[model samples]
Target: MMNFEMPQFALAAPEIWLGVMVCVVLVADLFDRSGEARFAFWLTQLSLLAGVWLAFYTHWGDSGQTTFNGMVVSDSLAALLKAASAALAALTLAYSRDYLRDRGLLKGEFYLLALIATLGMFVMASASSLLVLYIGLELLSLSLYAMVALDRDNRVGSEAAMKYFILGALASGMLLYGMSMIYGATGSLLIGEIMLAASGGENALLLAFGMTFALVGVAFKFGAAPFHMWVPDVYQGAPTAVTAFLGSAPKIAALALFLRLLAEGLGDLQAQWQVMAIILAVGSLAAGNLFALVQTNFKRMLAYSTVSHIGFLFLGLVAGSEEGYSAALFYAISYGIMAAGAFGMIILLSHKGFEAEQIEDLNGLNDRHSGYALVMLLLMFSMTGIPGTVGFYAKWLVLQALVEAGLVWLAVLAVLFAVIGAFYYLRVLKAVYFERVENPQPLVSSRGPRVVVAANGALILLLGLFPDTLIALCRAAFGL
Candidate 1:
């Protein structure tokens, strides 16, 4: 007789809870006759809140615990990332609510899809096996694909969705193939076992090939250059609400994926992967900054900015140390907050029959509404990595990690590109404070979104002013 032990399902309490709520929200939305989708909206928010609570409650103290036969993990990192992802999702939904309603895109499906995507992120954060991570990635990717096309009436949106789908599928296939090769070489699907096999330096040639493909997949996911063709088009074409969601929470999940697959599983191959990371980092910084300079479209410019920020995030990975990983994690979380605020401002300025997609549309914003303009100013400053903002601290941490790792030239190069990136962000502030238009439209107002946007902007400054607490939390996630 063979003896078997039950998998400890409780370790994944947050994921399980979120999975249940995704179904509950789906069913609740079906019965909701309110054309405004009030029930579904609030229910989704409640679900997110519960998910955040569960993440911390279940895993706050855990250093690390693998369960589900080593397919899933509960740890400080997973707990923090999951909570942050869920909170960002809630904020994204909050910011999108009024904008979606005004544009007639407010529906139960949007809320449901967002929840499902959040659930996917949770799974990704906790996944310990390559197969489990791939499953989570697909769930997140497919939901995002659908969300991009939710505005079916928009041809540009449909085209963007198709492009995104094809490219995303291709990337997924490459990632799976890479994982298969790794499994074949290591004779195991588990990340720990892969690390053990890789550290032995047996089958070095095959392992290198598999790692190369895996790096490409990771680069594509991060919107790093050479594989970042989809970012600008999708960001510009999707509804502002969808773009806002895409810009924020999914980033935390991507960071989770990067840490798991590269920093954890492939740690033994650090020298090889670190060199590749440096190449991606430099390429992304140059391309993202240079391309962004000419973009008149606000969303497209931010998309390139995102690629550049990913470059900075990669600098930490290039360091290949635990402190570097924590620094990268901090950068990811900070960027997510700033990105949300940036997109939220776009949504705030837009109204029925008007889209605030162009940089010129922001002219005389201060004259029209000083308060909102101030918030926009803060976001722009932060994105520019100016001193006394979270963006600055985030960039500083990455550079510090680089210096510690003896990559002084790379650190200096990053600073140069960062200086180049500042121009476009300054142009945004110039429009807000200096430029005047013939007629400025009144800013739209929704109590919920307005308050959230205000808090979001304040957070950038607050975190900048006192970053140690969050920094410590990030370090703790790595048991440093």
Candidate 2:
């Protein structure tokens, strides 16, 4: 008789548990007779906490691990990104509850979709094969498509969902086609095997062509310009709560995708992919900043701001060094936190029948709520890369990595665009502090969101004041 043993599922405990809880939440929602949103909310919070706990428990003090026939991985980077995704998800739900309840859209579906999406993020973070990565991406993508249309009665929401679905499908095709080409050239489905196959430069032309298509797909998913048409519309139309979730958690997972695909699998073809990344980065910076300057809608403006930040994140990746990768990862985490806080503030100011999405909505906010205005200041300052904020450190690290890579001209261009970007950020500050109030309604928010937002802002400043630990953690992800 042949001896047989079961695969060790413990390596993916975080993902497994998250998936189980997602099903639990979905089923439990059906039996919820009380019809209270709080039940679902508390359950969602517990699930996210459990995810974080599992992620930390499995990877703490462990260099790295691979299991399930190398389809999954448990490493410092995966652990950190998974934990970040869970925390961001929990905070997003907290910031969303009041807004959704006010609009009568606070159903269990929102929390269920968010958690399922977060589970997909964990899968992407730990993916060790192209097939596994694509599966995770589709899971997250499909969840988001539905969430964008969650407010089924809103025409704008329906339109945004249609556009997102169509565009997302096209991008998925591009990614799939590119993966097919890479598989044909490398003759392997495993990333490690692909790395070894491509290292020999056996099919350089095929690899380059494949990388170009793959890069385009990555750019679209990252919301880089030229392919960033979906961002503004989606952000503007989706409920602010959904927008908050979309803008934050998925970014960490996207970064993981970039590292796993471009950095680890195609490291041998760096020169080819680097050029494509640079083009995407420069275009994103230029278009994101220039277009954001013309937007009156706050969510649209932040959408464009997201594009520019992705440019900075790309710079670190194009540099192709351990320091560069860590810097990019660090930037992704910082941006996620800031995005949550920025959108959370919008939700806080909004009340029943008011969206608070216009830049004018913030007019004279300082006169009414000085404390909230101060928090906004820190978030804006961080986005503008001003000193004494985590945003500054994030940009600084990317520039440092670029300079080290001898891309001084690119670094200079980035700084100049950053200057332009700062104008829009400062424009937001002017609305808060300098302009007079246009609406007489008071800013209403619940204690939960307020407390979370405060902590989010405090953490940004705290990380800015002392980012060594974060930097060290990021570096440790790469064993650098």
Judged by lDDT, which candidate is best?
A: 1
lDDT of 2 by residue, 11-58 (tens): 899999988988888888888876665667788899998898888788
Report lDDT (CA) for all predictions: 0.90, 0.90
lDDT of 1: 0.90
TM-score of each: 0.98, 0.97
User: In model 1, where is the ten-residue run with the lowest total lDDT?
Assistant: 438-447
Query: Model 1 over residues 1-480: C-alpha lDDT tens digits?
Result: 956778898899988988898888888888888887888899999999999999988888796789988899889999899999999999888888888888888999899999999999999999889999999999999999999998999999999999999999988988888888888889888898999999999888888888888889988888898889999999999999999999999989988988999789889999999889999989999999999999999999999999999999989889999889999999998999999999999998888988988999988999999988889888988888888889998998999999999999999999999999999999988998999888776765878888998999899999999999999989999998
Candidate 2 has its poorest 10 consecutive residues by lDDT at 437-446
Give me the runs in candidate 2 sitting further than 4 Å from their true place: 1-5, 438-440
Candidate 1 residue spans exceeding 4 A from truth: none
